[model samples]
Target: MAVTIFLLIVAAGAILFIYQTFLRDKWIRQKPFPAQHEAILSCNLPIYPALGEDQQHRLKQLILLFLTRKQFYGCAGLEITDEIRITIAGQACLLLLNKGWQTYPKLLSVLVYPSAFRAERDQMQDNGTVAIARHDLLGESWSNGKVILSWDDVEKGVSDFGDGHNVVLHEFAHQLDGLSGSTNGAPPLRSNSYQSWARVFTENFEDLRHRSQRGLATVMDQYGTTNPAEFFAVATEAFFEQPWQLQKARPELFAELQAYYRLDPREWQRSTEND
Candidate 1:
């Protein structure tokens, strides 16, 4: 009886694995998002046209998977619409392209406000005093499987894809960062690349901090100096939006990002120009 029970358990496990590996993928593919392609084209995501045909199709699949799996909620009296959903999802999924197709497995929901929202937090002072502070925020990513954004900023980010200030990208990068069990600058990287990623990020982060302190002009945003995590998120923004400028100003950092993301936006820009 014990052996028979064990064999039954094994058979059930194999059946479950087969269902997950085959049936789940078929179901996801058949799930319809009729406006997916049109949404991608109309969203004004400059990187969309830069991708090859296969990559573009994969991106659409990722976006559809994102829409299927995650929930979007409107906040602060904002009304959620397909355009808003597609716009935000498209930009967020851009980061997943050429990487694994997991559409932020840990992310479950997105909350969007009509504009910048006020958030209050307890601030720890250098003097060891805690004080309540309120600040306006455009976007935020929480480790609790939630992402919040300002619809206004989302639209702005899409409108000016070359500006290197995408709120969606920035916040989503934070989500990716948090996947490593902590919100530190480091995300899960291959064993071989971790050392190189650390070295390059540390050097560039220090340089940006020093430049900010001296009031020197820098291609990266001053907000990056806030912390290592912010530095990674901000760098991700620049890497995608201002690829040419980032490549010119900080080639090593750009190279590191290229290796990590497995694509080169500079090459995309070149292709765009040539065409």
Candidate 2:
């Protein structure tokens, strides 16, 4: 009798999990995306118009899923609104449109501030004494189920997507990098392609660092020179924002990103240019 009860409890738990995940996802799919939200996406995210119909549909679906799963919190007296949620969701989902993940599974909450916020951290001084240091951050991604962003920077990044300085893209790319268990520059690759990704990214990372050391102005962001993980994030920003410049300057790096993302921003941009 006890064994049968245990089995029933396990089955019930499994059923509930399925209902929360897959069944609710199906139910959400049937619901019409709000026209107001559509207007927000159309206005805030310029790339939305460039997306093909199927991609646009998929993007909206992904944004819906993201909004459903993740909790958004406003800090610094900022009120969380549909515009803020939809705008952020639109850009974040843009990265996942072709990728397997619809929502950032590891992420549970998004904390937004009105503007760049000061963060404090413990740092070891040269004398072996730990000191508290404060630095202003526009956006940051954490491995512990949270992403923090400045609303001001988010709007800036979304409005000028071609600037190649999107905080959303940069931080979300870190989330993708973390999906593989390592927050290193590399994310999951399809069918043993990590070798090529590693080679191409390593070479480009080194080149960027070298160029930055000489104070050279390059299409790649100088901030990427900080580390490999940062390099990958900035590369993702450039890949989507200035695809033409990135492709022209570093075809191999662009190709790796194109293969991993399974989309060609260059083609999208070309069509948009003609339009």
Candidate 3:
């Protein structure tokens, strides 16, 4: 009897774990999103107001699941609050909307600092030796299930929602880029998309790099010239924040992103502008 009971308990535990792992996300989506959270998004997340009702519904579900799953911590004596969590998650969820992928499946945590923070970097020296240096940063994404951000920068990114330079979007783009392994400007793609994505991104990256070297102005950030990975992230920043400009300036690049993201930011912007 004792052995039978023990076996039963283990089986029950296993079943519970399986349910939580598989069924919980669908369960979360079936529920209504909180109104208070919507208020927070409206006030703190500027992009939320621009999203269409259906997109907003999809994003709200993503945000709710994200808040429940990912942990958030405060650094530099900062305090973590629901408002901060909601705002940050809302911004990050913009990338996940209209996709069936689990909410940042690889991400386990978010770390927020009160302001710009310094981190160490390793640089290759002339003789191939490594030199360590420290640099101040507003945001960073780790392939190991972590993202770090400055609260000040987060606030700035949302406040100027039209600037096409959002740190949250930028770093989260890295998170998505790293999903397929090394973030070499290519994330996992649907069938037959790799060729086009690679071609368009390569041309745009090279164009941006040349223009940046010549100190010419462009719709996409000059910082995108840093590398293929940086180009993808910075271009993602522009993709959502200034879609109209990007669509006008680089229609092919915009189309690739529109297809990948499965949503049109131009429509959102147009709706907002018409209002």
Candidate 4:
């Protein structure tokens, strides 16, 4: 057992060396966001416009880290340009804007598709039926250094930010949740907040599930009711996009999210409106 463990560690070190020395440069190249990207910074991304000066700078630094650390791969004959990568990275990093940029320390790769991609999902039924099904996915996050997204949907997400649907934010939110060893809605919390986070999340999740089942209007997407993980991601979208609506419709859930994300979009919106 000791010999086997030693060999495994040696193999892991060799793989890391090869990846850093050869495979990484051949696959992805990192570059700073140049001045030209600034036009789209204000054009396609209206969310950044509402942020305060400090927040905007912090978000930019976060984007730079994502660009440098994460590998961007293009699928379906697509070319992964700096523009596409930065735009996607910027939006994904927006989720961490209030939470500190270092929140995404585990992410390493970002795979981008030209459009909606398909994946095989395992489905089990109560009647003893089990099947593998194909799912059309916009984005996905993995604990082991991978996040996948559809580039077209990413553009659409930025274009339609106010509509409360952003695949990038949704998937990155899953990445945060994955930090706790599982993507069951709760991420790694400070020592004092874990129990309360779980309790509030569970209660609100049930409430949202009930509301969804009853056909009631909800501030968060009904897709959230699919699972606790989805609930967190979908709620994140609504929190950033339609903060006032979320606060008015589900004040408790909104408060929980506000505490988690550490930024109040309602305040940003009010300041933007006044300006």
TM-score of each: 0.91, 0.94, 0.91, 0.84
Give me the displacement of residue 25 in model 3, in angstroms: 1.5
- Which pairs of residues have clashing backbones in candidate 4? none
Model 2 TM-score on a 0 to 1 scale: 0.94
lDDT digits (tens) for residues 1-275 of candidate 2: 99999999999999999778887898786679999999999999998898899999999888988999999999989999999999899989999989854588899999999999999999999999999999999999999999999999999998788989999999999999998998999887876898899899999999998888898878989999898899999999999999999999999999999999999998778878889
lDDT of 3 at 64: 81
**Per-residue error (Å), model 2, residue 174:** 0.8
Model 1, stretches more than 4 Å misplaced?
1-18, 30-33, 125-127
| Stretches > 4 Å off in candidate 3 | 1-20
Model 3's C-alpha root-mean-square deviation from the true structure amounts to 3.7
lDDT leader? 2
Question: Which prediction has more favorable TM-score, 2 or 3?
Answer: 2
lDDT of all predictions: 0.88, 0.92, 0.90, 0.83
RMSD of each: 2.5, 2.0, 3.7, 5.6
Which residue pairs in candidate 3 have backbone atoms (N, alpha carbon, C) closer than 3 angstroms, thus clashing?
none
Over 4 Å off, model 4:
1-33, 125-129
Cα lDDT tens digits, model 3, 1-275, are 99999999999999999888778778888788778888999998776777778788888888889988999999999999988898899999999898774787789999999999999999999999999989999999998999999999999998899899889999999998998888889998997999999999999999998888898889998989889999999999999999999999899999999999888888888878888
lDDT of 3 at 94: 90
Q: Over the stretch 119-214, how does candidate 4's per-residue lDDT look in tens digits?
A: 998899788899898999998988888899999999998887778899988999999899888999988878888787788778888988899899
Instruction: Give model 4 RMSD, 1 decimal.
Output: 5.6
Span of 10 residues, lowest total lDDT, candidate 2:
96-105
